[model samples]
Target chain A: MLFVFTYAQQKGTAKNPFILNPTDSTVVWGSYWSEMPPVLHIHSGDYVRVRTVLTSNPEHLIKAGVPANQIEKQLIAVQAVKDRGPGGHVLTGPVFIEEAAPGDVLEVHIDSIDLPIDYGYNGIGQGGFLSDEIFDRKTKIIHLDREKMLGHFADGIEIPLHPFFGSMGVAPPKKAGRWNSAPPWIHGGNLDNKELVTGTSLYLPVFVKGALFEIGDGHAAQGDGEVDITAIETSLIGKLHFIVHKGKSLQWPRAESATHIITMGFDRDLNAATHIAVRQMIDYLMQTKKLSEADAYMLCSVAADVVITELVDGNVGVHVMLPKYIFVSH
Target chain B: MLFVFTYAQQKGTAKNPFILNPTDSTVVWGSYWSEMPPVLHIHSGDYVRVRTVLTSNPEHLIKAGVPANQIEKQLIAVQAVKDRGPGGHVLTGPVFIEEAAPGDVLEVHIDSIDLPIDYGYNGIGQGGFLSDEIFDRKTKIIHLDREKMLGHFADGIEIPLHPFFGSMGVAPPKKAGRWNSAPPWIHGGNLDNKELVTGTSLYLPVFVKGALFEIGDGHAAQGDGEVDITAIETSLIGKLHFIVHKGKSLQWPRAESATHIITMGFDRDLNAATHIAVRQMIDYLMQTKKLSEADAYMLCSVAADVVITELVDGNVGVHVMLPKYIFVSH
Candidate 1:
């Protein structure tokens, strides 16, 4: 028998200790702000269930002929919130983790991400990445098959879905001022890395007290580079477990899945970004795999795959993926 | 029960028509030159069994403790070629093809790449891809298990091998002057794309008469970026089928395997290069799959992957890979 499950009901069973809803007024719409108040405060090693709305306006979706019944009610309510963004994404929260301060790392374990709807949209704009090459704006509505775990694109084409949050970050350093939720930076907002699906843990450096962590921009499926500037943009409910590492600090976002360790680098210059990713990967191998710096560097060339995360993001992203299977011991 | 086999005996049947060896004095060392005379000439749709030596000096290999017996006699003799280049790669040839001229496309189908030796080397120099990040120069000899199709990296590490020619291209336009083999331009030299393995076909724009096609810099295996500037550098004997497409013209190199169609872009500006790749991919999908430009662009975002081919190439390379499976009809 088919049954509907609510986030509250899922959390009531004690599977999730804290649940943060996007409907809360404290939600930061469009941009990340260090000065924004925390919506919820929790300690290290706490499991928080969070929800996110697609980075789009309900009116736009309806205008594009999306069925009214399929429109998310929470998203409709979120549009009425007075406090919004200086940017474009409807970010969920800057949930604070107690004792998370500078010189520490906030490790986020993505437990699960579920699509609340059976449809999503992909948009391409004239001013987006590759705009010079493709000078046109377009949007596409895609149907998602939950059971098949696929996004039906055309008559015979289907995209295998691997849902993940496009944006996940702690607040920027206090002096960085308000940040747009588009270009990913040291703070890790809008990473748009398709590989950070379920079973992955994202590690971001803590810049301020309590590590105001935020998450949003859900994508049902995406290829590397997010070439057309969007994926299957859809609303999502996710469960994340946060742990603050006291002595550990990171310069950029790092992630690990069941089989691969991921290191990311972002900069306006792709070469510089690539360098950052390779250097970060070398550091990871040296620290975790206990390889010499030279060996790590050489191993990166022979083993690790450096992929373009996204070119659309103002700061282009590059990520190095090192398969864990290559390591003999662990 | 194991019997020794020679290349000639292996091709005893009427399968391959020409087998070109590298020991011939007609090899082009280091740089690609339009003036370099063709070593061999064949008509369109001809099969060539070409052999390439690893890009290293025999003296250097011996100094690195590679067993003298393991060094191929052809490589030792190739080092004596006086007409070397301003670069460092020991490329095999400028095999001319009849009826191939400027404005036409040369299709090189890679049938097979076999490693003649059981070992390979990976080197990291001071001026390669991640040179700024890694200042030291080092090289490591890796053991290859041909039967297992893997490169043994260390005690607990094994690298799966997918051998390919790192440098494959036709002569650049005669007016461009002598071109260094390092940067991949419109003529497609030193692409270093790991996906161009066996069963793949690489299409290049012909810039001159006979399309002086050259191929070398064999790699046992490589990651996407070739981050440390080298893969498991090794000698390879590959069989290639050349076909001339007089009606089809291309602005850049394109490739297709059994499952994926590949488009490449090269520029000093990675972003521009990426844009070129995305544009080319969209164009390809529209032309081959009968999709509209808008649909193809969106399809690329949802299904295709853009990978960093290499950053060290003077003109950074980006390639868009669209899985052919997306199309229902072959």
Candidate 2:
């Protein structure tokens, strides 16, 4: 209820949105527990301007050469949350959506992502794709150029900036108990898929009452595989609009960008992950395009692109992006 | 000697170029052998318009419901090739480039690719990503709309047309002796990579004197993974200009699209293959971008994209594409 005053001050009504900032009581670290209580209650179609912080501690950021003045006070403040757990990511909520029960779908419309931070860091340690062969355990501090929308990577090199949340999900099935935030599954945590940028709508299936949802692990920019096990890890603020679809169901999380329909899968083996993505795509085509199973499978081979999302997570990921333009005039 | 009259009439000299069509005597199916003699000899800076035929048997194409007239007559005539592969692909070369010796780099300038065929096929077979689970080994014949540059994949589905030669490479090292054309290696054979479309230049490391170059396995369009183990496998013709860089040396094949510099790797293990691609990209950045090993490694994580080229090739493939736009004013 601490957010009530802030919500009212921001003129948050049933029709209007409010702001949710990370604080000691509002943020959870490392793992997701189904038993965790919600800190806020909101109705469907509500827009929340939420602010999330990177998992790195303020001490670490400053040690990595980030200026103290640039560090968000909220990040330093959240360090008092002693409940931090078995994992490392710091997530920002379990917002309980009223009437969102099991079997429902949570449609997250990512309206905007604002980047106010000027720096981030990429650390290379253990568990990366090539970590065994090339063990260079080091971290590089990358400065972001807001005007050019790029990262000053080296003396003569620059990287394009595409900001997005690397992790977002609801509570897992009750029987699963506490879940680590390291791997993404049916709950969709730590997807680390770069395609989930702004203007994308991620449809995640609801598994519990109220459909408690949380988001964090921001990336300033990342390549497809995240081969080194890190991106331009940074903090990001998002304005998200949530809609609860009561009748629809989805086996795997799906996403839609401005120009394409996206599907995802995660598995220990990259080959199996690829298979799951392709099959999900075929299922999507069969239902939406009204094509026979045979036709959908063939179309996937000739049309849709299945790309590696991340290879470092315990469960590597692969996603399918089928351009919406290809389904025109139907 | 047999092609002397044809070469002279077409003015196929050091500066000028001529066409080489696939015939029973000119084409080699499947395996690539270093002992294979060159069918044509040309100098550096020379252009060759190479025509290739699909490896499908004409009778099988007709049985799969493809119109008989749509089958290339050259495909029918190539049945007499007793040297037809220990593999399944039909390649149309062994074009020796004079002075192209080991430690040199052969720059293949792909000026254009013409898709004159009206049809192609996608076959799902064993060894595919999902073959063991989804055992529907059927072939689909797709019709091309030349005017629209699209493939009619289904009753209401249309796929954007992108034509390119799937198999194109030089001879492997002499020590390797006979090599199957199913996988790509230092020789770059059967690199089912779709990024090598029109206007893309492929750079292959020359392995022996008079680099024995071969090209075939055309595709009308394909997704990244080629999950079902095939694309719109079609016959295509490519106009390529070869330039021998006598001083340049490379360890693996590389390519460049209009907007990005590309690196590639192939291995049976996807993880190992990805490692190879990333290392090659790091090597590229260190050499061309003048970056230190640490800077190049960090730049790859922050900038370059590592994508799965194909999962079904005997040696699966991965490629890295670093966009050219990010390097401006540097």
Candidate 3:
């Protein structure tokens, strides 16, 4: 199934780009709707700087007795309209990229992610991933010390901050219908991987033409599993550059940082997802490094690390990391 | 079903201890037989210096054309007897520790692991964890550089060597029969976790009186999954001190390094194992830190990292690592 995009006039520049604000009417709430209109249009190799608010409601925070001063002004200003769909994350965008077509790959290079505020929240509810194991619901507001690059979790506990977008994806195949922004799939929505921080490139398979790329769910810091269903949830402004690789098709999303190449897989079964990720890494090694299949598989066993991105997402996420230093040259 | 151990005269001092050689008659191939006799006996708090060999036949390596000069003399002298059953791991002991009983916990402090030889092998067989994905059986010999702490896998690929015992466990519950040494259970055998290196303490639930602890299957280096079913398998001498916790109980094996506390879980289902590990971490936080369940769970989400130890083992292994720096004055 193909998706036809009615492109809008391009406005963002390579250096000083047009900002897609979360407060704008173009913001999507909860679900990734393939039919959604493109909020902005950009060509491949162009830059688009965007802003995203945490997936929370000012009314809910106020009702829960958070002081008015503690609430982010942006949170208060953004209208919480109920017209969105089947999920709960407040995502920003659906930026249509010119020349990105089906059977191609979209490469997103994350330049920087900046936190506008010095606070964030982590919430655990009865509907969390480990709800069967833990049956309580609570919220914790954490103070971020930007200078120290730490999140003050408690009086003496601190967490190192590695800010990144938890969700970054293109619209799925037109046949998949409107998808929830919770579970990641072939199109790579809500990956919730902490390793995709600054200086990393995320590659997603483009199933639809123009590649309606959306980004949201910012986290200041998060451990691997995201077991409690939330991270240091906060709003963020990110500088991103996009490039489309025509004729390069992928079955699942993959990423690369300075030190490592990453392969990802998502499925309801954790084992199945893990296998997919491992196979993808094996494929990458064989294709890129010119290693035999046996050598690639063995190399993975002795060198690659597989990690769970998030268990709470309906389709559990797994990623295999192969350190680049092992290769003679890249 | 209880197997009584006839104790031998203890000979080792806390500082200078007796060594249990893997080639001695005491070594057992494969299954952890409760009925097997202890090679040595020691009191709680006493130190035991032990030696282990890789789980490959010297004849096989020689037939594969490894030069006779390259093979360690000990490997050639150690006769590969045919009295092994159920599994194929060449485990070195069932060291009897006095005063360790069922319901107690055995705390094994790993003082050091040193390579006696400068080589190791990684093998993948048709019966491996990913056998369906990969059919060929192969072996790759690696050169270990002790001074550099690296395993030279190939011309340019160097794996950082983190030597640790792959299997460390006491005798299983007597009624469980002779258990194969492949899967890790409540008694903790073949965990294959790279984090259980020197200076770490592995805590295993005692299932038999005297805690017939055995250790073997050394690795110079290994990644998380052990996907090809082998690490940098090698022989090493390890110095370990044992202490029996009188009343402390644990449902699964737990460990602590200088920087983190680790909780483990094992199950046929990866997701189920992950849940068990996460729940164990939450329990650990609640009990030790005096935090509410909700807060503990949230803390885990923000600070703890859950990793896959190995997937090839019959019961897949998962471990949750909670960094100790997050706790104040622990």
**In model 2, what are the clashing residue pairs, if there are any?**
none
Summarize candidate 1's per-residue lDDT along B75-174 as a digit string, tens digits: 9889788876677887878988888999999999998889998889988876567676566788788999999988988888889899999999999999
- List, residue by residue over A1-330, the lDDT tens digit for candidate 3: 999989563555657776777764767777776787888788888888898888888876666556778777666655655567777877788888888999999999998889887888899966577787666677788888999888988877888889999999989999988999988999999999999999999999998878899988999999889999998998898999999999887989999999999999899989889989999999998888878888888888888998888888899899999989776632
* Sliding window of 10 residues with minimal summed lDDT for model 1 chain A: A7-16
DockQ of each: 0.58, 0.61, 0.52
Q: Which prediction has the highest TM-score against the true structure?
A: 2
Cα DockQ of the candidate 3 complex: 0.52
- Candidate 2 iRMSD in angstroms: 1.7
- Greater-TM-score candidate between 2 and 3: 2
lDDT of 2 by residue, A1-330 (tens): 365533234233434566788899898787766877887787888888888998799888888888889889989888989987777888899888887999999998898898868888898859777777667778888998989888887665678899999998988889878788888888888899898899999999899998889989999999888878899998899988889998998888899999989999899988778777888888888787777676677677777887788888898998988888777675
TM-score of chain A of each: 0.94, 0.95, 0.93
**What would the TM-score be for candidate 1 when compared with the true structure?**
0.93
lDDT of model number 1: 0.86
lDDT of 3 by residue, B65-119 (tens): 5677777765655565567767787787889888899999999999999999888
